[model samples]
Target: MDAAARQAVNLNVLRRHDPAISAIVDTSSHVVVYNFDSATETWKKVGIEGTMFLFRKESLNRYGIFVMNRLSTDNHNEELNSEMEIQVMGDYVIYRTLDDKVVGLWIYEASDRARIAKELEKWVVAARQMGAQCLQQSWIQFDVFSRHLAVFIICALAEDLLQSVDTDRVPSSVSATCMLARFRPDPPVSAHWFLKV
Candidate 1:
């Protein structure tokens, strides 16, 4: 598909200076990106075949992402309430928006996937310590997460997926690359290299 003529967004573009983008759903079957027009200040969306990218600046401390884990064209409400409910069941990590959109994550495609889950859980716990613990008191407010921490979560689960998984299983380099370059605490690596592989 001609992704550009349609102005389809790439998560890796990492242009953080755009208008009010609320969320992105980079999934396997479809891509849903949400952004607000700076001039018109209206919500807009761009969808491609199987992944999505979105960008947004804060609005009234009310900016929250409203994406789940699948291909969807249903993110049409104009509310910034991004309260998410998170849960860890066994080794699975579940993330749900209060409106009931949900997705779960665990380690796969890595050797010793259980260890990856364990390590990821540690990071989740750390985020809880640093943010507002919410819902069942077991998870925390994801909106409170810094972009740095959010990038870590994406990379931690899919670190070795450089060549093994399809684009559907891989989080876009967009989510980690420029997103991290903006405020990453560690030295930046060439994410393009990974994506090219």
Candidate 2:
């Protein structure tokens, strides 16, 4: 074969081995990444281990938000993780865990919160595509592993955001009466009611 033809064949083989899309997935509550840099343009891939913080709803509220770079899971977290957030920060600093080396200093801003949350909406599409291409069957058997995970992340954030209403902490002007009516009808249908003050 000619040199040009041989190189073309090698590139095809490499592409076949590479994934069509990359995904951030949760393999049973543990955040795992199956990123194929070759699938995307070199310039698109930042070539760094990006961080995603998965926090339990209760723990996040109780302890406040934190990123566990140490990758530890005690007996407490294993049992209860129904609601969670696969959170990526708007801006963050990467440093070695104390387990390896001391963490470095960084600056964080309040506005960064809104900027990062915008990324969650994009996960739905990426998750669906990830499930379609040739990937480990264990992940794809559900047809779209990341799709379900995407829903979970969205739901987790929604629930956490509504924690105030869930706990009856609304403004006095707005009675907790609407809060009481929540889900009295299982599987709320498409209906809207106008409140005439």
Candidate 3:
């Protein structure tokens, strides 16, 4: 599809001023959203294949990420409500939003990407038992705007993924990357690079 046709609503490319970051998943899918990066420019062919989870951002906030071993279900909705900003990092949950809206929360918490893989394995097994559609690696990637980091949450279950995993000890496969060039755009210019994932 054409580049312009691929973009979603909430994302205004004209608003993105960062040179290192490119696009975010303005649309939604069953698994995750996809994002593009320019700095050290990284590109993935997945976009053309119709990937569900992808996003792109201009910056990241490290302090917003929280790695917990287990998320408490006693007040599940309350936590997702109170935390405001959040993302599911493997078996853990990370917070990124400043207000209480269930939309546009750009956050990722796992800093070790490898351990996150292990945790995903566990999550998939459990999710399958519940009759949820699960995705394999290279299928889902989590884009945390606040942290500028993306976690490839492969093999996502077709259920409410945000509510499936534990919030604590979010494994260690997740990593954070900050793209600061996305904040200035008075004069529109071509981005140095564009990512497919």
Can you write out model 1's per-residue Cα lDDT over 56-139, one digit (the tens) per residue? Answer: 334432222223334443442222233444454443434454555444434233332344334334544544543443332322
Deviating ranges (above 4 Å) for candidate 2: 1-66, 69-109, 134-197
Give lDDT tens digits, candidate 3, residues 1-197.
Answer: 66566454323432232233344422222212222234544422222211122233333211111111122211111111122333454533333333422322122333433333333334334434422322322123222221222221221221234335463544444311111122222221332212222
Q: What is the C-alpha lDDT profile of model 2 across 1-197, one tens digit per residue?
A: 99567545534432343322122122111222222233452222122222333222222222111222223431111111212233343343222222332222122443444443343323433444444442454444443444545665665565566665545566766544454344222321321211111
- Of the candidates numbered 1 and 3, which has the greater lDDT value? 1
The residue pairs in collision within model 1 are 11-174, 12-174, 21-56, 31-51
lDDT, ranked from best to worst: 1, 2, 3
**lDDT of candidate model 1 versus the reference:** 0.39
**What's the candidate order when arranged by decreasing TM-score?**
1, 2, 3
Off by over 4 Å in 3: 1-21, 26-55, 61-82, 85-197
Error of 2 at 180 (Å): 73
Instruction: Estimate TM-scores for all models.
Output: 0.23, 0.18, 0.17
For candidate 1, the per-residue lDDT at 121 reads 44
Best by lDDT: 1
Candidate that would win on TM-score: 1
Model 1 steric clash total: 4
